[model samples]
Target: MTKPQKAIIIGAGPAGLAAALRLQQYNHISSVVYEIRPKPTTLGGAIGIPSNGLRLLHRLGLYDNIRLRAAETSNLVLHAIKGDVIGKADLTSWSRDKTGFGYLRIQRTSLMDVFYDAARLADIPIHFGKRLVGIVENSDGVTATFDDNTSDTADFLLGCDGIHSAVRKLYVDPNMTPEYSGVVNIFSLLETIMLPQARLSLDGLNATLTTDGLLALCPCTATNEMIYWFFSRQLSMPPGGGGRDGWEEKGKQEVENLKVTLLELLKDTSGEWGDMWKAIINQTNVVKFYPIFRMVLGGQWARGRCLILGDAAHAMQPHASQGVSMALEDVFLLSKLLEIPGRSLEEVYAVYEQKRRPRTDRMSKMAERNGNVRKKTGPWQLWLQECAISGMMSVYNLCRLDRLGIGQKELAYDVEEEEV
Candidate 1:
């Protein structure tokens, strides 16, 4: 019998937990997880899980659970800044038959709960509050040291840490860092009764292109009594603003300032439609603020037996909503490569990069375009955007003509099927 393989994983977020779950399936693969955070957080807003990610989650026995806690949207309806409907992208029926799953929108915390539960059931050890500060690799394998003064040696290490990955900086490339996306995304939760217009607009994912930024709203809970919404806009980094460069969450005073800034921008909006959106911000109790960031797309993912995945490997602009999905895909693909025989750890790492980089590069570019489009638009630019969207969605609703893969291509990202 072959000896067991030992693996060390950093960051107990979605990527690390998913890696632990997949590796537990093979008795020969023994893995351990370490997280930087003190404990599990129910923070963050809703995330959209695409079909490619859904497929892997299903195989990991997570899809059914995710569906139970998730809300399904039929389509993403687009509206102009002035509250006129422009287009709709089919979300439910178009690709269900082909992919065996539709898009899922769920809170990030809910999904993390599921992953943590599965890891516990599998008896996988996850040490929280253990931050990775250093990594050392040799021909024998890799040794990872945590802030707690604990160290572990494994056949190889997988850096599932987030965008500010310690493993990547200490091992892969110390010079590489995540660049601020210049957009701060603010999300809030509100009762369905807070805005009647939003309740009526909650038929699906409602995305509006405004002069200030892009605002998106969706019903996340099953009862449809609560709505999750977010808005993205640019912010300038003040010189010597004392940690205003977008790292830590702001204090109570700063939060109030954010609300004031937002209200000032939307103060001009006047009407029932405007009130609905403004009320969403004014009446909310909890607001999540995030300064988006992205990494250089084309870079080395592996060096010797150490490699990175998830946000550590590629941090695309959140405009595409594929950051988590890409990480989910990476862990599953790595597990599949582990099944291949006669391949050294380094060899598998190379194949992992070979299989994944092309897709990440494409997403990186698409996210850039999408992010630019969502930025503050001029009069002519907003008009052109609305017209283009109206035309494409009109055609898709009429003839199901999705040359840009609106409903078809996105919901069916089966790389193996494509190869066949």
Candidate 2:
């Protein structure tokens, strides 16, 4: 009997967990996940699973379970900050017919829970509080060192450690760093009771565009009992603003200041929308702030037996809402490559990077462009955005662009019988 290949996955996020599950489907591979967090914590926001991502999860037989806790949306409603409807795009049947699944919005914590449960059932070991500190690779395998003064050896190492990946820093390329997008996002969750009027006004994923920035409110539950919202604005960094280590710590220290800034922005909005925004702000128990950052795509993804996937490989702006989807797609592709017989680890990593880079790079550029358009703050820019959105919605409706599922095609992956 052939010995099973040992794979070490860094980070227990969607990508890492999904990769572990996918590897389990193959008899030749055994994997474990290491998470830096001491325990599972609420991700505190919502994430959208587009048709492509939903379809992948469905194939893994986990979609039905997740669907029970998620909200399905049929359209995205664009509204002006003053409360006028700007445009709409149908996503229900159109997405299902095109990609074999509908779009879903669910709490990030819920999604992680589903993945975690599935991993547990599959008998995958996920070690918490294991912070990766260093990696050493040899011709036969790789050794991963954790901060706890322990080490693990595996035939391969996969980095799904997110945008601030330790694997990427210690192994792949130290010079590659995430670049700030000049926008800061403030996010909060509001219960339906807290913002009853806003809940009544939102029919689907609703967004408002203004000179200040974009405010998007997305329903997080099927019953519309809770809402997840975010306010993004172009913020100029103050001198010594983020400190030496960046905004992670600064964000915590300036929560009140951030709230004040957001409240002022809301005050500028008029009518019921303004009221809704204010209600959301007042009802929010905590307000979290983070600056958006994008990683430069198309660089080395692997060295020796170690490779990086997902945000570790191609972190992009969230405007396209493809971050998680792209990460899942990476898992699907990499798993397939790993199943190939007689291929060296280095060869598999090379092929994976060669095949995945172009697509991820393209998506990264598209996401950056989308972010730019959404972050417009001038009167002329806002007018142009309105016209562009209207035109795009018309084209989407007329040509049934949603049905095409253009960007989702390459993302679709089918596991082979032998791999399963």
Choose the strongest candidate by lDDT.
2
lDDT of 2 at 8: 94
Question: RMSD of each candidate?
Answer: 2.9, 3.1
Off by over 4 Å in 2: 1-4, 244-272, 398-420
lDDT of candidates 1 onward, in order: 0.77, 0.78
Task: Please give the TM-score that candidate 2 achieves against the real structure.
Answer: 0.90
Which regions in candidate 1 have their CA more than 4 angstroms from the true location?
Answer: 1-4, 26-28, 197-201, 240-272, 403-407, 415-420
**lDDT for each residue of candidate 2 in 1-420, tens digit (9 for 90 to 100):** 123378999999988988899888854478989999998775578888877788888877789988888887657888765566778876555556656777788888898999999998999999999999999987677899999999999988999999999999999988788888777777877787877554675766888887777888888887778788987777666457555465766566557675576676555566777777777777777877878888976567898888898999899988777888888778888878776677777777778777777778887887787677546477677778788888888787788775666544433433222132
lDDT, residue 412, model 2:
41
